[model samples]
Target: MHNEPLAYRMRPKNIDEIAGQEEIIGKNTALYHLIKKGHVPSMLLYGEPGIGKTSLAHAIAGTSDLPFISLNATVSGKKEVEDVVAEARVTGKVLLFLDEIHRFNKLQQDTLLPHVEKGSIVLIGATTENPFHDVNPAIRSRCGEIKQLKRLEASDLLGVLHRALTDQERGLGKQSIRITEAQLLKIAEGVNGDARKALNVLESVVIASDEENGETIVEDWLVDNLIGRIGLFSDKKGSHFYNLLSALQKSIRGSDVNAAIYYLAHLLETGDLVAVNRRLLVIAYEDIGLAAPHIGAHVLAATEAAVRLGMPEARIPLANAVIEMCLASKSNSAYKAFDAAVRAINSGNTGDIPPHLRDTHYAGAAELGHVGYQYPHNTPIGSFGGWIDQQYLPDKVEGTEFYRPVQAGDEVKLAAIYERMKEMKKNKR
Candidate 1:
């Protein structure tokens, strides 16, 4: 066997060979067509580590038969980029794959913009960080597309493991090694959808088995020893953390208690109590909304308890909050209403405040026509007896309907109360 790492030896030779990322590289997909035509634009591939960003870039270059040049933005400087650009200018076709493109500073990224614009090189930038936040806008704008890769599914990882086992030319097929389907699945789960980690762990087991005995027969204990130290796949400050948070909220919104708790466990494993607390609060108010406004207060109290108690113990209250929010009646009316109002303001519908509703305590307020303000509490048609007819919003948006409550949980009662109040106001008018 060549001494190359299994991940390296098993790199896909073409787009068809790439595992996972079917959304991007599947037949008839935009990226698949781009590579098939051998005319890809400057692109950014973004996702968590070991999800095949580098592999896909190489596959594109290989399948297209384009000259491939690779650089790591973390180590390479402006000089390296300039050198690559110069070389690419000489060669009419070159696919420059820059790994960890987020590591490049503004000056370094800017250096490649013109070359990319001029078609000197078809840039394929790979990053684990979100390009919008980490990459220079100028460079991001020049990239024709940003492709997001997801964590590989267990089935896909299993396929990768099998390929390494049986591909005699490049893999360990020549060795007398045997791994059960169950053992392969165990390693796949342990690696958290990372193909590189899966392969490395598999390779480690094979080597250890070889050293111990000429024949390599993988066992549960051997795999356990190698994988026992591997922690949950998470980066506290990276896209993985945010993705988990999103999943948690969506699960709650979808009322999938199991999924919500699952993602909650992952966040707590990272000791990210604050993110969990904040996102739970948002879900309570945004997702749960007026359907169960009490849940918002309950979630706040739980969050407070979590903060005071801290992890291990904190997870209890957080879990309680998550379950309650998940089971609580769901509504987004409050959230949508706020967004609608914001849109109106942005669209220049913010007319002058009704004079009667304007501040009247100022010295010249009465003379400036701010005196018609109704004291609803003092009036006979006040809320004590019944709601008074009044214009609360600015004239431009006077009759705008924003808070349309759905017949969900407490919102049903709210809708009834609102209709009654509107009727009373209409009678006064």
Candidate 2:
């Protein structure tokens, strides 16, 4: 308002003034509990940008009456954290706020963990990525995670736009700017639920307005200016993680190996190495799965190597891993089969394990009518020693082969193996 940046000027000072995130800001929520009674926790706040992570950190700071010391994980290291912790000893209710904390290396992250664990500082950290995969285990283990969902509804962004236009000391009220319902709605929808983005776009309008008789109406030209001003190859990293991830996932899902590879390269080149680990591992399982079953092992191992080796040295391995991963010959029989089977189980048709398939490890098994469970390995077929009438998959589920392997590349061999196993198990009875 007073020549400050729109983001800072528009920041809410009180709980009621804070927008959205009612679930977290509510009295019974974790952050609210930490606030109301001053029960601050060593916690990680993760979500996309403009979802109130930073503002929530401030709300926590304000509620606790602590000397909130914040450091950028992109720049700060162990030395800085240690210095802050030492200063916090004399201070009462010390809270250390870490932003973009996923940027810290393992050793750097490792250092702050002990202090958080030992209660030296009530650590409140923020990240745009999933901390479970993004943060080192040492730091993540000691902290509680409060997931902040991205703004997805038009109403949510509208609320912020309204606040920004009306909030006297903070928003366009300082400049006496006004906007029509349709124009505001258009801007809100364009923001895609990002409150910061919505406000920023509004700020552009406020600055561009010519003060038409002292009331500002955001015109179409200004709207075009805002959208057109956003550069394609700009800072699309932190603020647009989900967007990039969606594009990456869609590229893979749509079977465009080149586009998928391009996304992976972008992700590895800029984002964390471990970010792709989980999805790649799943692709190995879901897409590759039983087809080239060993590919999962390769994908997982490459992720580990990338993390251990870090950048430059890690680049080739990451690229190679994802390349093999993308071209591993897709198949979703594992997913299709598992999903169908899960639907059956969840619908309460999960019949008990047949006596023949159960209880060989216990002591009283042979004594309590626990007999006639044949050992398939000792049979003539050397396996699959069960009879078809045995109902090994439960009477209602027998002979239900959910995983029908695809007739492509490696899956053909996998399908044959599954067939053989079914045959062997069928004869064992």
Candidate 3:
């Protein structure tokens, strides 16, 4: 039994035998229907580890009754890819599933495009990283994408454990091993949503049933793996990653300073610090603009300081920066107003920049008669833009208000000055 590979013996024989990933394996799916119609496209499946991507690909190949040639992109170079392509061309309908498909460099990935175009081989790829980030654009452009999700439900894990225990050939039926539900659930709870890890844990649990002499029993001192403790924290690059980050971003955006700091701490302790900094920078500009212009600057300075400080020393600066961003008065006025003005101009509002305000800092100034621009400060009436007949937002649309400012922090001061200037010009006109 030790000489035989566990995965080979345990691999699901058919789609019915496989568990999870019903999102892709369930009825009416593109892959399911295409296999039925005898017209399956080259596909790519992406998700966290132990989510059954390779199993699905193998099952698909079985349905076609064609030889499945599995390739690992990480090790295979361009020459190897070319050889596979040659074989595929000769076979005409073989299934080639490339695991870690994104690991293939651009040149290696390109080797498959021409062969794929000719339909010599059906290319199915499996990747762990987000396909949009990891896969070559050309490969993604040609293949339909199937995204697998991490194991979440404890019941789903229990299903795998039971199948392993009572599946006759696959389970412990070969030996006289008796186990209670408590021990099994403990192993299952420690599995961290990965079926392969769960099965491996079961094997270990059985082997150590009696720690001292290796005798069989339901009780033993079982050492927990890293994946086991991971289930306790709940975010070891799994489902909680996105949700946690989302809450962090919104915390800063909504100006909850304390909450933002708390989220930053959680990310630093459980997630990536660099990612937290990246989001903080975005939150600074996107959510807090001219109203609190210092927010973006503060975040950038904090990032630079963190890079210089490094590791343990960097934590305080990171927290301070995130707090600063949250404490900053919120404003999207500058961005919204700028976008509005641009939209109006692009929509065919070919207007002039009032002659009085046109660029006068040039060589041949007097020849152009660039004067009569009341410098507002010099005149009581202040002919701000010369004759008010000058167009600003085209003749069809005059008085298009764009830059409305929020009354907070620096924006309040700017808005007041801006309004006063606007009032004087409109009063004279």
Candidate 4:
């Protein structure tokens, strides 16, 4: 017990012992009632690593007094699952907590369905990836609504730290160690909302500190040193990677420069320049759009430079792009207009191309009534250059206005031009 990791030793024994995730485990919460009633159902827990998914599972088993068994999907296979099922049949039921359950292949995941459907196995799957995106639908269907555990708040982590320091049975309470509230807060906040990380850091600091006069004191500098370079929880293949990209784009769109750069730094840390670069370009064109149209070119150049430079150094250009994007005037009129056009096509509103608008480059185009195409370049009219009143869109959508520019940055001027063009077409008719 003394050799075990603090995180493992301090695992919550009941739902009441769990910290954070009040929404999921609060006394009034459905899950809390379910566990207290010993009605632990097959379900999936999805969230960032170190946020108590495994702890919650253990707590459920403890509170229910159900026979508990654990296996990691990454290492275990059909045979191991069969064994658990066999044991479950003898025990009437077993709480099987499967960690990294997304690693189970389709067939492996299928094996859990029947046992889970029957009463023999109460499946509690833990995954960092979004269960909807990564888990098999069959497994997901039996699990019911997937529960997402949020990252622990600093205050929640503070509670965890204090518990570990005072619990003599399973914690460092036996040691004559002293630490200040400020230093504890540092550990709680530094781990990026991971309770396990906070506990581990405290344990390391205690291990390194030398006892003097039967008292081991933790210092601020040592806490910082142990928590060096906080590793953010994200992987190139996980939903968290996409979430960071989404956050970066939203922050930039909302003109929050600080948040935008923060998300950018996290994305860069993943060493996935392709996802980062691609998402930045999308933000430039899709969010900034006609508002700061030139931003697309600038973002392209920055991303290109980032690809050439490669990490650590690549972050420089990426940072510049993120800042510029955050400050840029934002508009989604271009994308919205394109989406509208697509909606029209998707709804089967497409009509035949007017004969005059059809291609006339071939030799027999005139015979095929592909003539009468009023070339805009030859029949220029109005202040808008190369403007003509001939219909370009197919008949059903001929008069449909898709590119309705917004009153933002360059789009303001472009919108004015668009209105003038419409007016010119009306007058010509």
The runs of at least 3 residues in candidate 3 whose Cα sits more than 4 Å from the true structure, single-residue gaps closed, are 3-9, 27-30, 33-40, 77-92, 103-120, 129-138, 144-152, 166-168, 171-192, 201-225, 228-275, 290-309, 312-329, 339-401, 406-424
Question: Model 3: per-residue lDDT, tens digit, 212-287?
Answer: 3543665634635423444433354544566568898898888787787777776776647677678778888878
**Deviation from truth (RMSD, Å), model 1:** 3.7
- Across 57-90, the per-residue lDDT of candidate 4 in tens digits comes to 9988889999999999999988988888789889
Residue lDDT tens for model 1, 41-129: 88999988888999999998889998899999989998998888788878875789999988878778678878888887888999999
- Backbone collision tally, model 1: 0
**Top TM-score hit:** 4
lDDT of each: 0.87, 0.72, 0.72, 0.88
Collision count for each candidate, in order: 0, 11, 0, 0
lDDT (Cα, tens digit) per residue for candidate 2, span 41-146 = 7778887666778877887777777788888989987799778877777774488888987787776665666668788778878998778777777777778755
Better of 2 and 3 by TM-score: 3
RMSD of each: 3.7, 12.6, 6.0, 2.0
Q: Model 4: runs farther than 4 Å from truth?
A: 379-383
Measured against the true structure, the TM-scores of the candidates, in listed sequence, are: 0.83, 0.58, 0.69, 0.94
lDDT of 3: 0.72
Question: Which residue ranges in model 1 land beyond 4 Å of their true spot?
Answer: 1-4, 14-16, 26-41, 132-142, 167-169, 210-213, 229-231, 338-402
Which of candidates 1 and 2 is the stronger one according to lDDT? 1
- Report the poorest 10 consecutive residues by lDDT, candidate 3: 381-390
TM-score of 3: 0.69
Q: By lDDT, highest first, what's the ranking?
A: 4, 1, 3, 2
Task: Give the total clashing residue pairs for model 2.
Answer: 11
